[model samples]
Target: MSNTQPLAGHVVVVGGGVSGLAAAHFLLEGGAARVTVLESSGRLGGKLYADEIAGVPVDLGAESILARRPEAVDLARAVGLGDDLEAPATTNAGLWTRGRLRPMPKGGVMGVPGDLGSLAASGVLSAAGLARLPLDHVLPRTKVGEDVAVGAYVAARLGHEVVDRLVDPLLGGVYAGNAYEISLRAAIPQLYEGARGGRSLIETVRESQRKAAAARQDGPVFAGIRGGVGRLPVAVAEACRSAGARIETDAPVRTLRRTPDGWEVAFDHDGTRETLAADAVVLAVPAPAAARLLAAESPGAATELSAVEYASVALVTMAFRRREIAHALPGSGFLVPPVDGRTIKASTFSSQKWHWSGAADSDVYVLRTSIGRHGQEADLAWDDTDLVRLSREDLGEAVGLTAAPVAARVTRWDGGLPQYPVGHLARVTRLREHVAKLPGLEMCGALYEGVGIPACVSSARGAATQVLGTLRRAAEPGAGQ
Candidate 1:
């Protein structure tokens, strides 16, 4: 250990994903003596990517960031990349229901019926379904203390029609997992808060909207970068380096342990065994990876980490000529409700959503089709070619496309997005408490709090704050004693 180092301490951030990178950036900005980022893969930006297709950029992983979340936008602005931000070309996203496309009901928050009148008018639900919704207003609230699955809660309050028609598809698009497995408290806290507030879900959303309007600061609902969403990660990485953070790629952390002084991180760098000493560490990888790394040091945390399940998914990007598609590629994209029983879960009209995606005269269309879900990994077992074919077929059925795509690309993510299973928030809370007992250690990623880009950013930023605070405390005279 280099005792004379400025701030006289080292901080190690494990995992090269967005969360890890963001943490490193913050630590450097906070004036840490040494900040080392260990990434298992040769490249950074774990799942975030921008691939070229027929001379156009397309995001294969996360497509957009919710503008409402200030974390991502703030980080972008801090890195001088705010000018690259762009909102969705169109805000209209439809749901494929009963073999027909129906526009997603407006004013619904993540498929929770915020406005029954809007939901009813959308024709997404039948007369009986609409009538059953208000039953929630009169029905006695269940007094359950345990975390309940979102599927069950929604069905209990709003009937199975809402669950099957809206919740499942919307959640599937986000978590890529079954609604029955997701925790209402963990996944949709606002909805849970609404129920606790003694108001119907519709009333809660209406009130929220009213308050937001009064605030006059509700930002864009969804937005992406001009070049691609991946640019945000790239900018963050650059900022970290500029701020004096040392990032090491191809450095896979094998184990972590608590040391009397601080912490020890063991990793393999190109087949060489190496260990780093740090005053603090942040584990920002996925749940499974975090579980494996923390098993020896914090078995309780490891168990909770392993308990969180993840779903595999693949993105099939296909491009078509301007005149190839029969139906006009109007809105941002469309989602396939599980009721449709289709291979594709959703498709995003990339070209239409972002101006930089294609040429003006070319009318190039980029479609991102998802595969795999809870108990449906086998659906993604098909070869890349077959997946492309199936995606094309599904798109043709949904949007009347007849022409062959000019280019096609496929990216597979095995256990990519974490599923916030029932009691997930409780488990995460317990894990965080356990980790706190181990001095100079932190964890952040899609598993703990949220899975979106903004969520990851928030977690990272929070971790950085903790690290900086600890450093400041330790620097005080006789502080460590």
Candidate 2:
């Protein structure tokens, strides 16, 4: 093999999502002789999907990239999409609770209020809830041994109202999980580290706010491409092909096995069964699929992966005439607290969030609602027509938006978000330990790291690096001596 081609042999990446595409790109860049991507579905991009609504393209899955992190942004620029990046017009979010819309309290970490003045002024809490705030300052430190549920720890320090109104809604937006069950360390590591320091949460949040203000980070917290985030996969895939990677759709891997030579990946493509031997393999599919594929090699990893749970949800997008709506949208969107018994958990004023989605003189306004979360899948059982109707009813009540929509579309995502419960970090540690035993085998995706696009890309890139390192070490002269 040539000196530049460290990972010279063939490599296969199973799963055509952004993670898989990213793996292919990294592998090709790392000098792999040949690479192939196998995707079960006819399409790619997984949850980073987009579709047209009212003649305007809108994201049906993850729409925004957290700009605070550089991974997703840097990747987009690398793939020739730097000029297309667009920041949101607004970032304000309203909290719907107790029969009115309250402005989200400022100076909070994951909805944990840092300043009592802002919380009290926002009217997010009742007199009793406000009264409970000072107790956090004087009360004895709540013991958080190794790790604890975010809700349990926050509620003990603050109160249940804060957990329900603030923390739950915020956590739901990301993981669709219950704060009472999510691990503090895994879900909200910053807050977890603060709690571990033994200082009051209020003090911790205030300190965080002080640091944030000192830095004064400018621009929007999130950014999106002009067409849609879904375009990301297409661009990345094209880049991979330029680097000589083959992408195959409608290819579902049936089994994976480790061999003395390297690895064997068997799959069915176009009504034919096929197997390919590779110097390395990256499993970029979901947890369940990965667990099944890894079972033959490492049952322990499979068992732990099987134990991981996922959350499913649906997005209902509707287009309405601006004149038909009664209230002007003060922010990009609003979050619904679960305690309010609303069918829709959150609503994004799409037109307002992304300038390209609508025009100032345009008659139609596009907005989308998210429904169903962990333990809230019953709503998803209804048909699309019913889901659209329920979303309209809730939006009408929440924002006095009684106008009939000009057009509507519903997208269902089954097993979309993964839940990270207490002790999840420890479980992941054990999984990694077991996975390390098998060389030339690596796994990546939302199941192993954060659910956002950046996290998924980071995971995929890390896997590529690991496999490449192994191949490099094996190639060294007198390697086994």
User: What is the TM-score of each predicted model, taking all chains together?
Assistant: 0.95, 0.96
Model 2 accuracy (lDDT, Cα): 0.88
**Model 1 residue 128 CA deviation in Å:** 2.6
- Winner by lDDT: 2
Looking at candidate 2, what is the lDDT of residue 181? Answer: 95
lDDT of 2 by residue, 104-153 (tens): 99889989999789899988888999999899989877657788999999
Candidate 2 lDDT for residue 354? 88
lDDT of each: 0.82, 0.88
Least lDDT summed over 10 consecutive residues: which range in candidate 1?
Answer: 1-10
Give the lDDT of residue 20 in candidate 2.
91
Tens digit per residue, CA lDDT, model 1, 164-238: 889999999889988888887888886777666566656766777677667766567778887778877778888
What is the clash tally of candidate 2?
0
Model 1 clash tally? 1
